[model samples]
Target: MHVPDGFINAPVSAAAGLAAAGAVAVSLRGARRELDDRTAPLAGLVAAFIFAVQMLNFPVAAGTSGHLLGGALAAILVGPHTGVLCISVVLLMQGVLFADGGLTALGVNITVMGAVTVLVAYGLFRGLVKVLPRSRRSVTVASFVASLVSVPAAAAAFTAIYAIGGTTDVPLSKVLTAMVGVHVLIGIGEAVITTATVGAVIAVRPDLVYGARGLAAPLKLRVGGELVDATPAPAPVEPVAARSTKKVWITGLATALVLAGFVSFYASASPDGLEKVAADQGIDKKAEEHAAADSPLADYGVSGLTDARLSGGLAGTIGVGGTVLVGTGVFWAVRRRRAGAPAPAERETV
Candidate 1:
């Protein structure tokens, strides 16, 4: 959920900002191991796709809706560290450019929506995959379950945070119940989206799926009463050209653009889980207006476009493009840091 300003007191918000910063710093280092030449670019596409899908909010209750948090989906497709960065990037873009989330509450959104969700989902997914069969179906199943749990877990995290730094006098029990209850419904939608997306990717290019890697080891066959590996030995790493993800990246980016630029128009207009919970529980009593509320792109609409469809479409397209550019730049920089020689500062100076 995109926490707006004043929902949490300034002190708690500042603490969360420090936590978010620390998480991002740790993720950047961890992502170096996850992002390679081929996967680095895919990380950007993941962020763009998450940004797009988040626009298509589906109805959860009569007046409540929810959208893809993208933690599980991103973690399953890429890796957890990169997944956190992907969502952090999207939240940042939405806060600064789109005004969907408040700038002051950026850390709250990042902590709850990015760090918590990714950690819970990735941990659960990894655990489930270890106990289940090592097939594509198993991976999809894990993705679904992991996604389902992550939403409520994030809700719980928010509840804990609010219990400590809430700006309103709402009862902690009420907040927890409402938040968890609505988000559980939202989790179903999250599960469906994550499962379908992960399944599709696994069907096409399992190699690109970080979680699915090494899932299905070489089968063994019994020979002369002894079991032996049936699959051929692994081949050497492919060249950068041979391993390029041009086709997949292009296809994913096109899908994101289509979803955001067009399909987002049909998404539900109701308040999402957090918004509904806040309004009902009085957690939003002190909510402040977004700093960018008057911006041209605020509320996901172009400044001059009168047509609702055209305005939203242009805004969505711009968001996708910006997210890709920024995400790719960040991920590429992280990858290069991993590949480049030691910095002069770290080297022994004469």
Candidate 2:
């Protein structure tokens, strides 16, 4: 959920900002291990995809709607460290460019929606993958469960933060109950989107899916009377052309553009889980206007554009393009920092 300004007191908000900053710093280091020539660019596309899908909010309750948080989906596709960065980038873009989330509340949104969701989902996903059968379907199943749980986990995190710094006098129990209840419904939507996206990627290019890697069943051989693990044959090295990520990257970018630029028009117009809960529980009593409300792209529409569809579509496209550019640059930098050397592919060009 995108926390607006004034919902949390300055002291707590500042603390959350520090915590979020620390987390981002740690993720930048950890992402060095996760990113490389192939996956660095892919990570950017994942962030843009998350941004695009988040626009298609689906109805959760009569008046409440939900959208993809993208924590589990991104973690399953890339890695947890990179997943946090992805969501953070999306939240930042939405806040500064679209006036969707308040700039003052950026840390709160990143902590709850980026850090909490990614940690809970990725941790749970890894655990489930270990216990379940090592198969593509198992990866998808784990993704579904992990994503479903992450949404409520994030909701609880917000409730805890509000309990400490909430600006209003709403009962903690009521707020917690309402937030968790509605977010549980939202979690289902998150699960479906995560599962579908993970499954689709695993089907096409399992190698690109970080969580699906090493899922191929090990070979077995019968020695004497007992079955024994067989030594795996060396994998054949394909031509450089065969290993190129250009096709997948192009396909993913196209999909993101289509979703944000067109499909978002049909999304539900109702308020999302957090917005509904805030309005019902008086949590927005002290909410301040977004500092970027005057931006041309405020409210996901372009300034001086009369057609609702055209304005929103253009804004969405711009968001996707900007996210991809920023995300790719950030990830590529992280990749270059690995072991204080550029990735192998980069060295090839050098």
Whole-model lDDT values for every prediction: 0.94, 0.93
TM-score, every prediction = 0.95, 0.96
Candidate 2 lDDT score at position 246: 96
Give me the runs in candidate 1 sitting further than 4 Å from their true place: 225-231, 234-242, 343-350
Expressed as tens digits, the lDDT of each residue in 21-122 for candidate 1 is 999999999999999988999999999999999999999889999999999998889899999999999999999998898898889999999999999999
Q: lDDT, candidate 2, residue 57?
A: 95
Candidate 2 CA-lDDT value: 0.93
Question: Per-residue CA lDDT of candidate 2, range 1-350, in tens?
Answer: 89999999999999999999998999998898888899999999999999999999999899999998898898889999999999999999999999988888899999999999999999999999999998898999999999999999999999999999999999999999999999999999999999999988888888999998888888889999989999988989899898899999999999999999999999999999999999999999999999999999999899999999999899999999999999999999898878577668998998
Model 2 stretches astray by more than 4 angstroms: 339-350
RMSD of each: 2.2, 3.3
